[model samples]
Target chain A: MSTPSTSSAPAEAGPRDKHALAAAIARDVPDGAYVNLGIGQPTLVAEHLREGSGVVLHTENGMLNFGPVATGDDVDLDLTNAGKIPVTELPGAAYFHHADSFAMMRGGHLDVCVLGAFQVSANGDLANWHTGAPDAIPAVGGAMDLAIGAEQVWVMMTLFAKDGTAKIVPTCTYPLTGLACVDRVYTDLGTFELAASRGRADGAVVVRDLSGISLEELGGRLDVPVVLG
Target chain B: MSAASILASYADAVADVEDGATVLVGGFGMAGMPVELIDALIEQGAKDLVIVSNNAGNGDTGLAALLAAKRVRKVVCSFPRQSDSWVFDGLYRAGQIELEVVPQGNLAERMRAAGAGIGAFFCPTGVGTPLTEGKETRVIDGRTYALEYPIKGDVALIKAHRADTMGNLVYRKTARNFGPVMATAARTVIAQVSEVVPLGGLDPEVVVTPSIYVDRVVCPTAQES
Candidate 1:
């Protein structure tokens, strides 16, 4: 239970480390975008968002314009993000009821929502909530609402599971969170964009970034056909 | 119409809650939870409760205390699996507690629908997910939406930062989650406020929950040291 000081923090990372990957995603966020960063890896994107980017963070628990995670004596249990981590409120922050908070998502007011996923099919189907293991407790939280609610859904995760299995697959074996809901995915290896939800077909995955791997090598690794962006 | 009664103590606030009542406990985690009120309900010994909240419970306080005491027969919530939710996890794994996991948005909207008197609404949040299985499905404007029904409660236990004697409420930051919505969706709404002001103290523009929706207001923090 020790906090890693600045000196102990990992060396300046390659473009594929989790923080770098988060930065890559934050770089592409349109200015003034209303974004909901999902729990886990997507949460780090908050640190990467440009100052004055006008990116208003929406925590489904009910608050907007939430600032980065709080520390020291600034933590207020009453002021927390969707992740239930105490955070500080930014200027122009507003709080609302849960009903209105979800309404913002369901009504498609969010410009982007980044989520973590177990698997993403080439067709853009998202499977993040459950592993389908019988003993695993199913807790969906707001993943389903965010996946389908935001104008664009981005995923952040490793390209492969701990077992060295590819996470991006021809079809998801896990229980689906939403059908054809993913717009982009940022992984340790590179960034990939799903075909538009409308005209997308099998093997239409587009490669937006590649780190330390050749296009053909990356294509050979994942089940989905990869095209250069 | 008469204003909400300003009850003196937490125990008296939940005195009439019957067993087997579906109680909506407001909170995201521990933020907006009416801890004293729930503790009072426990002391009052209302068992077989169906708890509806954002989270099942955390650690060994508040809602967790209720679950640990085996009072909650079922939990209708969005998320139940958390690091500190051992109380719920143990009950669920033992097949002792029923778990109904709704998407967070739907959980809120369903209660909103109950308060608004809407019968059922179609939502596209979980269209192709397992959560929508066996539910009514309709294709509107070419997109499929699963039909979801309202989730009304017998009692709502919530916490607010301040309340006027008229029961108009204002919340503190994100602790406001579910308090306003739960206020309208329950037959009997009880709120615990840190401070209660005289009538007309809260500005109408900032009153999140009007007095009509809140039946009882308790100042439990006043009784605390």
Candidate 2:
């Protein structure tokens, strides 16, 4: 949905905070979808999803249909998400062996999976599990499985790293979690989709929504070029 | 029926584990950790152990205590680092311990394969990632997958809510994670349960882990301050 503009007006401000970005992403999730929220920022998507949305949340730890963060006497130390935060089991929730839970993951039973990314390439290559630091111990965890197994992979992360470097890169220097698996990028700055071009190996990133930054200003901030929707 | 699998003490349950033994510790964080068995292992002070678990540990107990005591040589796990996993982080940063980070799905499948008598399986989980490096890759039905090997353990330390004298176990809620599968993958399985009941007391339909897989069952005593 686009608003036709006769004159060049600055695009509206992008998402102001992480919560806004998470809400932006949550609005796009369809009803009755089986979704897995990765650890970290992606976990917040659960809190922002439209109430009674019929979205079934899957945790790699072996529970499904768990409710939001547990509080007071509702907290069960054993019942937790992949992030190890206490959660409540909703009515009709089911538990299974770890293998069966993973089977649900690796068998493509999930409709969508929201993940956190360190760097996402123009061609949708994902690098999240490791930073490629010499002294850093690379922990793959369940990220690799969720990235490749889900039907659509949505990455929720800040547009830039703490050092002011663009996380959306022309090519990733970090170790990859999956090759060309990311479907959309949800950031505090804006939301983007990967647009592949003919005869080009690396595709272009098209901004579908803006928060506070204009197209030209957003392009000026990055090393790579970005297209406006 | 044969003799009951009940053991008199936690120490006796874990007595056969030796130096450099590979152990599968079942839990998804602190939920199903065999706390009593871990305490016994800590008291026993076995060294150079290789552990396979979902996480390193929470706070300073269970696997963390063993690791803090410098008893573990390596850890093959899915998620080894957590906010409360300072013990593992310290040991890992110091280069005192080795780490093998496997994808959670791959880790679970490998353990299941060990118990199921399967040699290896092709899984697409880690393909196109650094985890796939040095591993065999094959294209099946136009999709690339990595060949993962089964992971067997010398002993498995598991937790359950209840166990029958015959060693059949029943787990509770999400605490059941990895316990039943680990039992099948190990040469010896020692389960710490809250209660032990007579063989016929437990319903046959509800047994999560069959009696054939468990070697010893121990009920943890009340903790002393």
For every model in order, the fraction of real contacts preserved is 0.94, 0.80
lDDT per residue (tens digit) for residues B1-225 in model 2: 343368758987888799999999999989888888998998988899999998887799998998999999999998887889999999999999999999888998999999999999999887878888988989999999889999999999999988888888999878888998999999888888888887598999988998889888887452211
Q: For residues A180-222, write the lDDT of model 2, one tens digit per residue.
A: 8888888877887863321254445777677787788889987
- Candidate 2 vs. true structure, TM-score: 0.92
Q: What TM value does model 1 have?
A: 0.95
TM-score of chain B taken alone, every candidate: 0.97, 0.95
Summed backbone clashes in each candidate are: 0, 4
Classify candidate 2 by CAPRI docking class: medium
lDDT of 1 by residue, A1-229 (tens): 3764332232233337888788888888999999999998899998888888899999998889988789999999999888889899888999999989989998999999999999999878999999999889889999999999999999999899999889999899999999998989888777887844336555467876677677888888887778878
Give Cα distance to truth, residue B143, candidate 2, Å. Answer: 1.4
lDDT of 2 at B147: 91
